[model samples]
Target: MGTVNTVYWIFTIGLAILLLTAIIVLLFLWKNQGQLREENRKLRMSYDEIEKKYTGVHAEQLRYKLNPHLFRNALNAIQSHAYQSYYALDKLSGVLDYILYDTDGRLVTVKEEIEFARNFIEINRLKTSPLFDIRIKNKINEADPRCHQAVIAPLSFINPIENAFKHADLQSDNAFISVSFSFENDSWFVLQVANKTNDLPPSLNTRGGLGNDIYLDRLSSVYGVEGYSCKESINNGIFITELRIKIS
Candidate 1:
């Protein structure tokens, strides 16, 4: 009986030591797990910051890519009509200011962007006349404070309109370019541009839609691929492009 008691005490002490060892191991694992979670959180935050910066950098690059195309057109119009009206130079200044200062890859107000498009239209009109079939419809309340606060990617609305002009069958009587801007809702801004396709020389016709590709890339970066909506179609000799963005 004495030997048995001694053996039982030894077994109990061994079990107690084993339990203590297991508890210590569990505590160590818990501490390391918490530290790992913290490290992972920090790494995720750093990755997001890097991604945002990369987006901004590439967005800026895309915006500037077409600045030269706009500049070339505006300067040509200003030079072609500089002798006829002093207004050409004034319009040129506005275009220059907008292109130089406002194209910083930041979100701009709806009013500012539409106004820039209007200014661009007027500048380009120096090349055409009242008889030209260029139609513009605007249905947004610019005075609303929300329109000012609601923002979208800069230079986002111009590509389709510019393409309409560039590819339009201007010499034909049936050629018409129509552009519209309106708010489908308080937070949704939409731009639609349609034009009759023109038959140009192979040189110009071969490179169609290159500008719009850049536009798409910029918007994809700004709003994500699925965040915004775009629809393009061609029917009965008319090419229509519509884009809708949810402003924040």
Candidate 2:
């Protein structure tokens, strides 16, 4: 009977030790798991921060990828025309069509660009009086096949046009915006947009729009220094922006 009791006590003590060891192991594993979860949470927060910065920078780059003056001013001009005329909507569809579809390519034909410029100028005309000094001289031969074959980078020429109309001092009797396009020696093409300057009313105040320098930079980037040349001059309150490019 003494031996049996001793053996039973030994068995009970061994069982208790085993259970204690198991509890210790379980506690250690639970603590390790908690540490791993914390580390994972920290990594997630860091990734989110990186992703947010990347998104902001990407948004900024994409915004400037497009020349804001081209499409934004087109929309504004279209809306203005909506209030003024209904009969000319068909003729004015060029701006809408270009905005929606035609301006998808990296390069566009001289003819199509010229038509776009003409449409833009015509629509802007309704903004001012009939006596406004707005002039357009398109010397490139429209019927020539080269107009289609000789291509240039798209959106290169229209920024200056939008700039001119936006800052033009229409209050002055001598205020003028003139646009001219010509081909030199049939090898290089030229585009010039000029406008007068004067103090504008608070209602017409247009500040902080992209200017000639931006467009000039685009010209240089698209067509290296040898392929393109741009000049901007402010002569006696008249702003002139001229761009010349070798035909592609």
Candidate 3:
């Protein structure tokens, strides 16, 4: 009877030891899993940050590529008026200064952008003869509290203006290009550019549309897809491009 009792006690003690070992193993596994999950989450966050930076850099690269084209056009305009007028050279100088210094920045004041557009249109006007009617109507009330302090992506309007000048029928009798800017509903900034198209080959009409695409890409990168909207239409030889941004 004594031997049986001893054996039963030993078996019970062994069983208890096995149960304790199993609990310890489970606890260690749970702790390790939690640590791994934390590390994985941190890694995902790091990846996201890196991706955002890369995308910003890529957008900047695309933006800079446009500078050379703009500079060339500005230089050509200055040369067109060489020895005849210095007004264009002066205007070109200001445009170059803005392009070189201010435009490298991600944003500029609405006033500055409007001024730049005006200067750009002036340069284009100088390039064309008096027969071409280039008109700019700026209805943005500088007195309006929103117009004074609002900021926008630099060179946003210049691309479409450039396209308008490039494809417009400047030599025709009724050649006209119009640019208008206004603040709508006190929350949205609207820009509209329309030009009469020339009777060009089908290929040329489609070829110069890439400038608008680049402009749209830059807008999307800066303001996001939901912050701005763009529309383009062609009717009766008139091509109109409109952009509206939620400024407030």
lDDT minimum window of 10 residues, candidate 2: 55-64
The weakest ten consecutive residues by lDDT in model 3 span 200-209
lDDT of 2 by residue, 1-248 (tens): 99999999999999999999999999999999999999989966855653443242322221124455555555565577676565345435876676556655335678877887787687777767679999898887777767876766665666768767777898789999999999888778899988898853222222324454565566665566798886767777888878787874
Root-mean-square deviation of candidate 3:
17.9
Q: Candidate 2: which stretches are off by over 4 Å? A: 1-84, 199-214
TM-score leader: 3
- In angstroms, the error of model 3 at 15 is 99
TM-score of 1: 0.68
Better of 2 and 3 by lDDT: 3
lDDT to native, each model:
0.74, 0.70, 0.75
For model 1, name the residue pairs that clash. Answer: none
Winner of 1 and 2 under TM-score: 1
- Supply candidate 3's per-residue lDDT for 164: 85
Q: Could you tell me how far off, in angstroms, the CA of residue 154 lies in candidate 3 after the best superposition?
A: 0.9
Residue 47 Cα positional deviation in candidate 3, in Å, after optimal superposition:
30
Query: Would you give me the overall lDDT of model 3?
Result: 0.75
Candidate 3 per-residue lDDT, tens place, 1-248, comes to: 99999999999999999999999999999999999999989966855653454355444732434646666776786787776458877777777788888777445567888998887788778768866788889887788766656666677777668888877887889989999999888778899999988875224346456665666777787777787888777788888878887773
- Report the error of model 3 at residue 196, Å: 0.6
